[model samples]
Target: MSERMIRVKDIELCTESFGNPAHPAVLLIMGATASMLWWEEDFCRLLAEKGFFVIRYDNRDTGRSASYEPGRPGYTFEDMADDAIAVLDAYGVKKAHFAGMSMGGMLVQIIALRHPDRVQSISLVSTMYFGPGWEELPPMEAKVEAFFNSMGEMDWYDPQTLLRNAVDKWRILAGSKHPFDEERVTALAERDIGRALNYSSSFNHSYVTGGESYLGRYGEIQTPALVIHGTEDPIIPYVHGEALRDSIPVAELLTLEGIGHELPPAEWPAIIGGIAKYAAL
Candidate 1:
């Protein structure tokens, strides 16, 4: 894989590409506050090996991408969707299969809704169809409380604190059947901390609210879609994935039996294979 900065609209996106551009492209978008690295390098290569040119990039505020204030981002969610299009434009790809996790999944839905002509297929993993307050099904009360309480205690000034927080958060959200890997999570947190801006703009994703209505527009999506969710997901309930499957006429839902809100390392093969098959068809 090769990494570089690509200009998208008025901002520059840090992007990593795998495989030949000549192959069909699969764009991966990560969740809120999470960098493109959340998609995992090995996972991208596996997809590429499955005959896809994979692209993963940091969204506006995360990673090595452009930085913004920690609060209100100047752009809207539609603009976030457009950022994906901009990445495609830079790569000279007119239409490509898209996959997103968490907030990234929401962005892909917008991309399909607003720019149908530019999407070949879509895959949403561990994400909800609805925007922030509009989720069809909300997460468990205890989990929600845990998330907020943890965030409240986080010392954003110390990157080490942020890394520790991430490790703890993953443990809470990871699938029960999958053994949590402290070492791997630590490595990812360390890498992200080194590259992340001093003041993170992750909260900006929640502050921007215009896309709340996009959930109502799922009926307009005609592209083939695959909705994958963990049956035990506590952050975004499995019901959210069911809602997406029902709302999109052509969408398919896959439930991972013992999984939670996270995409565990063990599930990569199945997830990547599912996306490749759906996109290839």
Candidate 2:
């Protein structure tokens, strides 16, 4: 694997890749407030072994990527979508299979709609549709809502406090099916916080706005799509996956039973297997 900084417009994004560049490319976009490390190195390697060139990157305001003032992102969600294209361009890849989680999934949808030619296939995980019907879908569970609301009270600057909050967030999102791996979660949180340029800037994702309306446009996507959602997802209900599957012409849903809004180590094999099959790599 190799890591490099690639320029996109005026900002630089940090990217890491696995496997042969000659193989089919799969760009993995992580969720909001998360760096490429959330994609997990071992997960990327396992996917690479399936004959795919896997690319994962830090989105703006996370990890080693560019950052802005905490409350002012200065870029729209659409610009972030364009950043994906820039990453592909930096790698000399004209087209790639895209896999994204949570907010990353939303970006994939935008890319598929806005730049169809650059996408091969899409994998949307633990996210809801962004268009018109989104309001009708179930809201996040009460506990999850409360947790996000409570973020204002936490101290983001202190490493120990940040670590504790991160661990707590993961625990809440892990659902009831599997045992919560506190040790593993804590270690990852530590690394993510340790490697960031300005970890606090990640919160800017909440304020990002898009210039265009994607209203009722899900049906316009003709590319093959795989919508993966945890049955127990608190942030985005399972029905959102069903909505994507039904709206997209060539989309299929992969239900992660007993899982939550997370990509736990236990589910990596299944998730990887699903992607390999879906991408036909």
Candidate 3:
């Protein structure tokens, strides 16, 4: 794998790629408050081994990307969506398949609607539909809600405290089906915190503003889509995936039974295989 920084507008985004550029490109966009590291290096390599040019990048305010004040974010979600395009442009990839998790999935939806020509396909993971009818879906799980509500109490400056809170957050997100791997999660949290330009800045994602409403436009998307959702997902319920599959003209759902809002290593093979099949089409 190789890493590089690409300038987009006034800020820079750090990106990493695996496999040959000649292969079909598959861009992986992680969720809010997460850097590209969340994609997991071994997972990327496994996907690349399936003959794809896999790419993962840090969203602004995460990893080595541009950051803003803790409570203030200079850009909007629209800008973040465009940043994905900038990554594509920088790599000379005119069109590529996109696999996004959570907020990243929302960005993929926006890109497919706003810039249809640049997208070949999209894989939505642990994310809800951005258009109409989302309000009627199941709300966040109570435990998950409580965890997010308590985030303000965390002392971001204390490494140990941050690590503890990060692990706790993952424990809630991993659901009951799988055993919580505290050591693994802790190591990843440490890596994320240690490699960031300003780890606290990642919280700026909570303040991002100004994205044009995609209301009632889910059917407008023409690109083929794969909606992957964990049945036990606390953040985005399984019904959201069903909504996407039903609303989009060319979309299908892949349910992960007994899974939660996370992409655990055991699920990588299934997820990667699903994406590879969709990309081939």
Candidate 4:
């Protein structure tokens, strides 16, 4: 695997890749406030072994990438979608299959909507489309809310506290069937903290303002699409995935039984296979 910084517009994205570049590409987009490492090195290698050139990158304000003003990100979601396309252009890839988790999934939807001809296939995992009543959606599970709500109380300046909060948050969202992996969670939190340039700007992700709904455009997407979600996902919930599947005319839905928000190792085989099939690899 190799890592490099690719310039997209005015910002630079820290990107890494696995397998041969000559192979069909599969770009993996991580969720909100997440770094590319969330995609997991093993996961990328698995896809590469399945005959794909896998690419994963840190979205702006995360990892080794450039940082924006704290509490205020000047760009919009459309710009982030364009950043994905810019990454493709840097690699000289005309088109590639995309698999995005949570907020990343929302970005892929926008990418497909804006640049339909540049997408081969899309996978929306643990995310929902924006609609008129999206803001009025029911509150998250109590434990889930409590877990995230605790973020405001933590000291962001203290690395140890941040890591503890990160580990605890993942533990709460962990699937009951798979249980929690303490060692793995610890490693992930440490890696994320180490890679982050501006840890406090984590909240900037939620502050991005002004974006239109994709609810009316879902059916207009011509690319083959897949919606994968854990049956027990606490963050986005399974119903959101259902809504996405129902909206996209040619979309396929894959529900991982008893799985949660995080992509555990058990669900990878099905998720990777689903993306490969959707991309017709």
The all-Cα superposition gives candidate 4 an RMSD in Å to the true structure of: 1.6
Point out where model 3 deviates above 4 Å: none
lDDT of the structure predicted as candidate 1 = 0.85
Over 4 Å off, model 4: 131-137, 213-216
Find the number of clashing residue pairs for candidate 3.
Answer: 0
Q: Give one clash count per candidate, in the order shown.
A: 0, 0, 0, 0
Instruction: List per-prediction Cα lDDT, in the order shown.
Output: 0.85, 0.91, 0.91, 0.85
TM-score of each prediction: 0.94, 0.97, 0.97, 0.95
Better candidate by lDDT, 2 or 4: 2
Better of 1 and 2 by lDDT: 2
Model 2, span 121-219: residue lDDT tens: 999999787566788889999999999899999888799999898899999988777899999888889999999999999989999998356534888
Query: What's model 4's overall lDDT?
Result: 0.85
Candidate 4's residue-wise lDDT over 74-173, tens digit each? Answer: 8888887888888889898998999999989989988888888889999998887565456665546899987777787778889999998888888888
Candidate closer to the true structure by TM-score (higher is better), 1 or 2:
2
lDDT of 1 by residue, 1-281 (tens): 99989987677889999998999999999988888888889989989999899999998788888888888688888888999998999899999999999889989998998889999999999877563345336656596666767686677888777788878877788777878889998898788778876436866776766666666677789899999999888788888888888888798998898898787779988898889889977
Q: What is the lDDT of candidate 3?
A: 0.91
C-alpha positional error of residue 144 in candidate 3 after TM-score superposition, expressed in Å: 1.2
| Cα deviation of 202, candidate 4, in Å | 2.4
